[model samples]
Target chain A: MTASVPAIINEFLTGSFSTIINVLKVLIPLMILIEFLSVYHVMEKLSKKLTFVTKVLGFSPSAVLPLLVTVVMGVTYGAGTLMEMNEKEPLEKKDFILIAIFFFICHGIIETTAIWGTVGANVIIISAGRLMLAGAITMAAARLPFFKP
Target chain B: MDPVVQIIKTGFIKAIKTTLMLMKVVLPIYALVVIIKYSPVMPFLERAFEPAMRIFNLPGDAVVPLITGLFTDEYGAIAAASQFDFTAAELTTVAMIGLVCHSLPVEYALSRKIGLPAGKIVIYRILAAVVVGLIISRLGGVLL
Candidate 1:
C-alpha cells in the first residue's frame, strides 16, 4: 500500500534489515557468554593468568584487572574499569597512557571478531593480527623513555 | 532466581540494548548507501576517493564504509559496506581497520578520563588503523 516510497528505499530497508538480523544472531549469544563469564568470575581467573604477562611487560600489578576487562570487553567498558581503578588504586601517568594506547588498538576481541565474522572475514586471522599488533605496539610504547621513565 | 536464568536475562537485556544502539547507526547509513548507489553523487565521490582507496586494494566506494567506520561505529561501516561487491582481501582489510579504529567520538571522550589528550588518541588510532590496513591488505591474498 505504501507504493509512494521509492524502490531504492525498499532495497535499502531490506538490505540493512537483513544485516540487522545477521547481527542479532551473533550479538545474542555473545552477550549471553559475556554475562555468563562475568557472573562466574571468569574474568578474575583470566586476570590472574595475565598477571605474569603484565609483569614481564613492566606494567604495574594494579593494571591487570582493568586490562583484562577492557581487552575482552570494548573501549567503553574498559574505560569504566580504568575510571574505577583510577579512583581506587590510581596507576601512574605512564601506566595509564600505555594502557590507553594498547586498548585503543585492541579491545572487544570476541564481540567484534564475531561481528566481522558475520560478514565472512577470517575470524582466526583477524583476532591473531589484532593481538599481535596490540602486543607489539604496547611493548614498543613501554620501552620508550616517555612511558618507561 | 537461578544463576543461569539471571545470566540469560541480563545477557538478553544487554543484547537488546546493543541491537538498538547498532540500529541507530546502521539503519540511516545503510539507507544512505542505497540512496548513494542510485544517486548522481556516487560517481563523483567514488572518483574522488579512488586513488586513496587503491592503496588498500579497495574500490572508491569502499571509502564510504571506511569513513563511516572511523567516524561513527563499525555497525554502520559494515552496513554501508554491504552495498558493494568487495573482494575477500578488500573486506578483510576493511575489517582489520574497523576493528582497530571505530567510535572515535565516544571512545576518545571516554579515554580522556585517563588524562591522555583525546586528539592524540584519535590521531594515533587512525595511524594504527592505517598501519594495520596496509599490512592486512598486502597479506590478504594468503592470509584469507
Candidate 2:
C-alpha cells in the first residue's frame, strides 16, 4: 500500500504539471503584453474617449479610468483601482453599481481574446460586444424605475 | 547595450513576471476542471445544469463550462465558448451573460471579506447577466 502511494502521487503531479503548462502557453504571453501596456500608461489616451462614451451611460468621467483599465487588464486590477479611489473619496452608490456592472459584463481582455481566438472566434468582436452590452445595460438600468443605483 | 535593446529586455522581464502571476491564478482552475472532467461526480451536476442551460439557449455540454466559470472565472466560459461554432452575436451574448453571473463562488468569497452578502450578490449578478444576455441577443438579432 505504501509503495502504491508514490505511483499515485507521481501520476497526480504529472497530470497537474502538464495541465499547468498547457494553460500557461497562452496565458503567459498575454499577461506579459497586457502588463507592459498597463505599466506604460498606453491606454490613457483612449480613456478620454471612453470618458465621453460613459457619460451617455450615466457614469461620471472619473469612472472611465477604472472601467477602461479593467477592460484592458482584468477585473481584479480594476477593482484594486476602485478600492484606491474609494480610499481617496467614497464613490456614490450609483457610480459603484455602474462600475461593478460594467466589470461584471467584461474584463481580462487578453485571456478572453486568446481563449476565443483558439476556437476561431473573432477576438475583436467578443471584446467590443461586451463593452457595448455593458454600456447598453447600464443605460437601460438607469432608465428603469426599480433600479436604484 | 543600445537604448532599444535595454527597453526590450526590461519589457520582456516585466512581461514574464506578469505572465507568471496570471498563471498562478489561472492554472489551478484549469487543473480542477481536468479533475472534474475525469471524475464521476460531475455528471450529476451536469444534469442539474440542463434546465439552466436551456434558459440561456446554451447546449447541455455548456453546463460544465458555465459551472466552471462560476467557480473559476470567465476564462473557462471562453474556453467552452470557443469549442462551439457560435456566431459573433451568440458568443457575445453568452459572454455577456457569463460575465455577469459567473465566478459566483470565488467572487462571493471575496465579497464576504468586504462584508457583502454573498448570496444576494450572486442573485443580483445572475439576474443582471441573464437580463442583459437575453436583451442583447434580441437586440443583436434585430439590429445586426
Candidate 3:
C-alpha cells in the first residue's frame, strides 16, 4: 500500500506539472502580444471601426476594443483588458454586462478557426456567425427593462 | 524613420507581441491535454462527459472536447476536435454551438461576480446552447 501511494502521488505530480507547463507555453506568448498591441495603440484604430457595430448592439463605442479583443484573444485576456481600462476610466455596470455577454459568447478566434478549418469548415462563416449571434444577444439583453442599470 | 514607416514598424511589433502572448497560453494548454491523454485519468473524464455528448448527438469520445471547452476554454475543444473525423457541416455546427455555450466555469464565475444568480446563469446558458446547437446543426446542413 505504501508503494502504491508513492506511485499515485508521483503520477499526480507529473500530470499537474505538465498541465501547468503547457498552459504557460500558450499564455506567455499571448501576453507579450497583448502588451505590444496595447503599447502600440493598434487596438485604437480597430475599436473606431468597430464602434458602429457595437453601438447598434446597445454598447458604448468604447466597448469595441474589449469586445474585439475578447473574440480575437480569449476570455481572461479580454477581461484583463477591461479591468485595465476600468482602472483608467470606470464603465457603467450596464456596459460591463454588455462586454461580458459579448465575450462569453465568443473568444479565442485562432483556435476555433483552426479547429473548424481542419475539419473542412469555412472559418469565415463560423467567425461571422459567432460575432452576429453574440452581438444580437447582447443587444437584446441590454434592451430588457429589468437589465437596466 | 518617416511617419508612415514609424507607424508600420510600431504596428508590426505590436502584432507580433500580441501573437506571442497568445501562443504562450495556447501551447501549454495543448501540452496539458497531451499529458492527460497519456495518463490514466482520461478514461474517467471520458466517462464523465458521455451524458453531455448525448444531448448534442455526439459519441462518448466527443464528450471530452465539449466538457473541456465548457470548463477550461475552447482551445481544449479545438484540440478534442482535432481527434475527430468530422465533416464540414459537423465542424461548423459544433463550433457554432460551442461558441454559444462554451466556457461555463468562467462565465458562471463572472456572473456571480456581477451579482447574478449562479443557477440562473448556468440554466440560461445551457438552454441557449441547446437551442443554438440544434439550429446551427440544421443550418450547417443547409449551407454545406
lDDT of each: 0.83, 0.64, 0.66
Q: DockQ for model 2? A: 0.25
- Model 2 Cα lDDT, one tens digit per residue, A33-124: 66556656776777876676766888778878877788778767777777777789767767767776666667776666665555444466
Rank list by DockQ: 1, 2, 3
Q: A46-101 in candidate 3: lDDT tens per residue?
A: 88877788668887777788777778766666767777787898777788777776
- Specify the poorest-scoring 10-residue window by lDDT in model 3 chain A: A15-24
Q: Kindly indicate the candidate among 1 and 2 with the higher lDDT.
A: 1
Report the number of the highest-TM-score candidate.
1
Which segments of candidate 3 are over 4 A away from where they belong? Answer: A1-36, A119-121, B1-60, B106-121
Q: Which residue runs of candidate 1 sit more than 4 Å off their true CA positions?
A: A1-5
Q: What is the number of residue pairs that collide in model 3?
A: 25
Candidate 2, superposed: residue stretches over 4 Å from native? A1-25, A120-125, A145-149, B1-48, B75-97, B109-120, B132-144
* lDDT (10s digit) by residue, model 3, range B46-143: 68876766565555556555666777666556655554466777777677777667777777886675444566667766776777777676677678
Q: Model 1 over residues B1-144: C-alpha lDDT tens digits?
A: 998999999999999899998898888888777777777788888999999988888889888888888788888888877878887778888889888988888777776766678899899989999999889888997766
Q: Return the candidate ranking by lDDT, descending.
A: 1, 3, 2
Residue B90, model 1: Cα distance from true site in angstroms = 0.8
- Error at B120, model 1, angstroms: 0.9
Task: Point out the worst 10-residue segment of candidate 1 chain A by lDDT.
Answer: A1-10
